[model samples]
Target chain A: MARVVVDVMLKPEILDPQGQAVQRALPRLGFEGIADVRQGKRFELEVEGPVDDAALARIHEMAETFLANTVIEDFEVKVETSEGPK
Target chain B: MTARPSPTATLNGGPTGRWNVRIGVVTFPGTLDDRDTQRAVRIAGAEAVPLWHRDKDLKQVDAVVLPGGFSYGDYLRAGAISRFSPLMETIIDQAKAGMPVLGICNGFQVLTESHLLPGAMLRNNHLHFICRDQKLRVESTSTAWTADYTAGQEISIPLKNIDGRYVADERTLDLLEAEGRVAFRYLDGNPNGSLRDIAGITNEAGNVVGLMPHPEHAVEPLVGTGRTDGLGFFTSILKKLVNA
Candidate 1:
């Protein structure tokens, strides 16, 4: 089995209020010099068979169609690993 | 929420019986305002039919209302998951074919997700859930849901939500303004930081309208802040369907 991952984030031009709130609290938590922060969602998928280019393409389509609202978000799909777990 | 009279009997003595005009109110799993929307429809002298999200049929209703609520628990995005529901497929097809559809609050988010309307809703700039009575100006009376309201008329309706800000590209905004597709604009100090104070908008054909405010809550004069300003939406569509 193989694992695929999709990371979704709001477009750079869109406002992310939740991320901003977290950023505002970082200083109080002793974090410093963080230029910016943006909150996003991550989806992990388990493939039943070998992770091939065709599977990647299908996952990309899923990201575009259901995982992300392209109007305000951008998503990237990556193959976490090509081999099954030990 | 207040204790309100049952909607089983309408004040108009059931004109729906004579006109045969039935309006559908769709309910998703997590929907909360479907009943109020049905009551609004009944008060407008039309039959209110309940439509389930999992069902593909629209029950032969002349028009449909997607009421406010956090469908699918607003997971992933406000309306992303619900837009893929079986009922939305039919809505999208019918809406494209010139059927009248109204989306309120979270319903507006679904319309955007379905691509039936442009732009997506974002979290309020202040990062807080706001609930209040909001004033909005009727900008375009040409839409099926706004014909009973004269242009430039300011009305107060209940607005509530966390994701209520509307955003779109500058070109699309300009095009909407140019074509008079901007159906409503926030009047008194933008409530949720919507772009250009846009409270509501209509599709190119004016059959689909989506807004952040809860017009269904303000339809009855005795309930919901005791204002009937929102009844114009239902009445407007009733006239349009009857006349058409």
Candidate 2:
């Protein structure tokens, strides 16, 4: 089986409230030197067959259309091969 | 397809018999304001038809309204998922064909997702869910929704949202400004740090409008804030559809 992972994050220009909330809480929790923080989301897709270059392209299209809103956010996809002998 | 109300039919708050003009209010799974939208439509003296996110048909509504709410639990960005719903597909097609459409708050987010309008919504710069009566100036009266308000007329309506900041590229913003497509602009103060105090916008065709405020909440004068400023939106569209 192949696993495709998609990561979505707000554009650098857009404000991220949840990440800011975390950054604010961390200071109270005694963490320091955090210049800034931005939150993001990740999705894992398990494909039934091997993920080839075409599969990666399809996953990218899916991410663009559904998994992430390109208007305010950007997305990246990575494919992983199973760790097994053929 | 001009939708006309029956002759000699009086529109009352009760039965509203003999009226044929129907306005559709869409309900997504997590939508929180469908009932308020329906009430506002009925109060505006039209039939309010409930449209489901999963359905493909608009039930032959003369106009469609996407009301405020946290649709799809605000997952993957607000309105991202709901925009792909079956009903929204129909709405997008119809809106492009000049069917009148209004999107309020999260519905505005959905409209942006569907590409019916430009720009995008982001979290409030203050990172808070702001709910308050807001003042806005009607900037364009040429659209189907704002005909009742004269240009520069100021009105107060409820503004509520966590993700209410509207952003777009400079070119798109300039085009919107140049074309006079800006329907409403925030007054008194910019509530959510939106670009140029833009509160709402209409499409190039002037048939679709999306904004970050809840006009449905302002229809009843007794609804706490005592503002009936939003009734103009409903009435304006009713007149437009009837005249079409």
Candidate 3:
């Protein structure tokens, strides 16, 4: 089995209004315990067989084309394992 | 009656330059939608020129588009570093002189960073990366980039982003509304907690426009969403060129 991890976030310069809103509401919610809140998404994929460079690139392409919007987000892909040929 | 030199000829020396309008689409280090923006311009029957973020010149393109994508990996801010690019200086000057300019998604963030338009984009209310087919009402049609759309015309476009909220001082928001400068408004639910549900806006002269939605992605019917509601933006500029 092969495992892949994807981390998605807004491009650094893109304003993260959602994060700001949450920050603003944190105090109002009587949860002043939070210092800051920046939000993003994470995905984990398990694929079959040994993960090769080509397969990794395909996964990246998929992330770019659909999984993430290159406009506001960037993604990092991590391969956890690639077992021997099935 | 005397005839004026073709706009294309005055801009770029291309063959059949008589009627074709040439537009430049700028690509920053991390730009993601430059290719799609160029394709949209081409499909609209205009020549699309690719411009680099580091380049100081616009290459004499009649109009310009700053496509979406992270620039400089959003290191300092989403568009903060990119706002200092040499191309932005030229674009700012040209846009001030009435050249048409459009900014989409990350491009919109860059514009806000540059202070070309008054406001800033912030994180969404939900604190999540929101992606969906968004409905927007064209709030104003006077802008050179939006002439083909009618005011109040609701159209659908693809929206994908994390930092997509629009914000400004209350007074500034009031002025934008009073002056009818708001270019587009979000319909249905607010995607990113944008103030007053604003999806887009234009400058006073109606030459520069900025919006958080990805219109380029909606220009093609064969692509993911298969909605072409965003093609009007490209066609509108072409019509403006033809009339000019």
Which candidate leads the pack in TM-score? 1
Q: lDDT per residue, candidate 3, B170-243, as tens digits?
A: 78889999988899999998888898999999988888899999888888889847888899999898888767
**Most accurate candidate by lDDT:** 1
Candidate 2 DockQ vs. native: 0.57
lDDT of 3: 0.83
Query: What TM-score quantifies how close candidate 1 is to the native fold?
Result: 0.93
Give me the runs in candidate 1 sitting further than 4 Å from their true place.
A83-86, B1-17
Q: Score the docking of each candidate (DockQ).
A: 0.84, 0.57, 0.13
Docking class of 3: incorrect
Model 1: how far is B206 from its true place, Å? 0.4
In lDDT terms, how accurate is model 2? 0.87
Q: In DockQ terms, which candidate is top?
A: 1
Worst 10 residues of 2 chain A by lDDT: A77-86
lDDT by residue (A1-86, candidate 2, tens digit) is 77778999988977676788888888899999897889998898999776888888888899998888787789989876587335
- Per-residue alpha-carbon lDDT of candidate 1 for residues B80-146, written as tens digits (9 for 90 to 100): 9999999999889888887889999999999999999999899999988999999999999999899
Query: Which of candidates 1 and 3 is the stronger one according to DockQ?
Result: 1
TM-score of 2: 0.91
